[model samples]
Target: MRSLAFTAMLLAAPTAAQTAPEAQRPIAASKIVLVGDSTTAVIGGWGPSFCAYHVTSFAACVNLARGGRSSGSYRAEGSWDLALAEMRTPGYKNVWVLIQFGHNDQPGKPGRSTDLATEFPANMARYVDEVRAAGAKPVLLTPLTRRMFKDGKLQNDLEPWAAAIRKVAVEKKVPLLDLNVESSAAVQAMGEAAADRFAQLPPGSAPIGPTATTEIEVRPMAQPKLSFDRTHLGIEGANYFAAMVTRELAAAVPEMRPLLVR
Candidate 1:
């Protein structure tokens, strides 16, 4: 009778642990992993702020984004492999990949550019499939708009690539955040001179020397820079865009909505 009673107590211990409050839960509710190009990378993108301020304690946010990677280059260079490995980690209640690409996939950028009509959408679709295969959910974001203006209106060179992403998201039923449209509208509202505040250099600050996306944000803070980019992001830009991402995720991805805190 003592042996039976002891076994019953042991089994109940684990059951009690399993029912603990989320803050005391052994496994977290979710993990959010950011995946994409410079616009999503830390030193130049929204990844840092999105991870720092938006996620709840129930979710651990991991930014694996690298600057200068297009959908093609990110995989070709093995960066995507690193990101995929993160998705495979055990114990998370759920994992999600937020993907944004387009700026580098346009024209002029050599190694990163994909044939917009074909390779671009194909690559995005494959990422969604692979993330699902790895037991993670995938959320697609249209490439963020470059804050450039000519004459009276904001120049939207990213329209085609954003459209391609939209098409793939619809076909695959992946959650889509149209950052290209939303960001451009935000930039235009600020006007050209003021829009520069969103850039890695902003407008008036003295150059803080030079830096890269992979460093600084993870390490000690450095003078803000995106190496060869002034078009990327400054702190204000990261916060602004990160908020946009959080807002969009709430609306489009129901699973992540509850885990997002202020």
Candidate 2:
């Protein structure tokens, strides 16, 4: 959900250019590579658990997603090049690239915003072409849903963004995983307060995400009950949503399904 408070917090002009990513470390070629913003990055989004649990021993799931990046900025920051480099690694006969964004591309995010109608679809299309050039399959996932609600119904401000991704998926003939639709349905079924359990929360507080781990991190505080994070996830939340993707991938990406854990 795009909120005024968050918008205001991000109004500070971005500083100097980001440093180039660290030197690439060679690892085994993976069957799938995930690319997106914080919502898919390790330690914050679903990538960690998605790779850990959903991937089968026969194949590796490499999550190359990073936080706070949008479709454009990620390429600008050289992360996309790094991702492509990984896709080019030898020893992997086939690979899949999962691309999901839009949370940071929404109306108010300063450094990460993209026009809903034009820039977004164009960016996605470019990614698909480049992934194909690298000899890997590309899968486009609509942005994950934010659990914001009003008047007992969920807000779908992100609908246009999801629509953009879907349009590109169809236009480009790429596989689509409508994570936004799936996640919104999941939240609606759980209700508001119950849905809050999926967010990252203060330590010792009960909820979704990695509370078992997040709550245990030491923060310097006179009192420890004040920290809260609603936009991220822990292991539990990741596992729950990762399962959603796996199920969708099974049916939607029939060929890739054989490589996933059943």
Candidate 3:
């Protein structure tokens, strides 16, 4: 009887050790990961404010966007790899990745741009697969419209890229946020002069040296008129875009409706 009892005790020890951690393990809920470049990155872009002020308490928000990164480069720089790792980690069973790229995908910069024919959609498709493989959903966002205007019309450079995302969304049956279209319309409605307020600049009190300080220029409603960088919003600008994101997500995801701030 004593020998038999000792063996049972040893078996029970392993069960207790395993069961304790299982019982204490915290449950992981749904989460969203935003992947893109500087335009979508937290802080410098609108993504930070979007995650901070827009979404409700129900979902976890993670923005993995980096400055000056294109879709090709984001993956190449291993940012996507880091994002993939995060998705597979414990408590991310209901993960969703939102991908937005393009500004840098144009054929000017080295290592940043892609051919757009095979390279663009191919990268997007690969991202979809990797996200799904990690047991998460992938949502494609058309690049946001740059606030460039010509003759009272919003000039869209990202049209093809946006179209590509839409195409991928249709093919993969994934959710999409047409930020490109929505933002274009939004900026056009605001017009050239009003839109300039969105761009960033150094504070007025900063000293301006003769060398011509890029940081210390008076930010006019359109002062740097030579360049129409009037579209990229500052913190407030990101908040606006973030609101649009919430609205679109609420409509498409519906289940996400309760998680958005009405």
Candidate 4:
């Protein structure tokens, strides 16, 4: 009886020792920072849904994206500094930054448009370098597709910018989400009338206008008014694209899988 009792005690001792350390061990939390334009910003972009629904409590998700921001203006206006500060914050096990631009980077938008051939790629490479310098991993994302159709075919005006971003990702050897390709294909399959449902408001009878040439001059702390447009996202659009981002992110960075919801 004494030998039997001693063996049982030995087994229980190992179990308790194993579990005690695990119980006392701190859970390593990760931080995700989003940097981009209106397509990734709150209210008008997928960032809200991605943070609200896709991430688990084990992650700190910060959406620093803004409306009408391009790669150039985002840094010029001091937004990149804020994002970099977040990346440098201590105590996170891992930090990841997702960068998407291009809608406002196209020509004609003064103070925002970057020369696609030179400035755009250079800016992206700089961002990747800085993110690494701050001890965070950087993931590059192509711009979300604009939900516009011409003669039943989806118009992918952002392709040039997406190509530039892809080239940067390749040259930098960073993870690329290729959101433009995924989103453009998804929107094309949905067709014109179906895709219209993704707009912030119902698309009326008028034709979708050309891309806005001027950057939206919104106050720093005020919410921008949302109107019916192909460029901005509705809740449906947000949820849809947010799910895409979540899935693609999990795949692109497998270590993030445990922190994300499918």
Q: TM-score of every model?
A: 0.82, 0.79, 0.78, 0.85
lDDT by residue (1-262, candidate 1, tens digit) is 9999999998777676687876853555688999998888878888899999999888989998888889999999998899899999998889999998887887788787899889998999999999999999999999888877789688888889999999999999988999888988888888987877777764565666645576655765556444323368878888988998899889988777889965
Q: Which candidate is the best by TM-score?
A: 4
- Per-residue lDDT of 188-255 in model 3, one digit per residue for the tens? 89996666666553224243223444555664232221122453556667777888887887777776
Q: Candidate 4, residues 84-129: lDDT per residue as tens digits? A: 9999999999999999999999999988999999999999999999
Off by over 4 Å in 3: 1-28, 202-228
lDDT for every model? Answer: 0.85, 0.82, 0.78, 0.93
Sort by lDDT, top down from the best: 4, 1, 2, 3
List, in order, the clash count of every candidate structure: 1, 4, 1, 0
| Model 4 pairs whose backbones collide | none
Tens digit per residue, CA lDDT, model 2, 1-262: 5697788777765644544566786554458899999879876688888888889876777888988889988998899999999888888868899999888888777878988788988999999999999999999999888877899998867788999999999999999999989998998888878777776664467533322335556764442222245567756777788888888888888988667874
Q: Which residue runs of candidate 4 sit more than 4 Å off their true CA positions? A: 1-23, 205-224
If the candidates were sorted by their TM-score against the true structure, best first, what order would they fall in? 4, 1, 2, 3
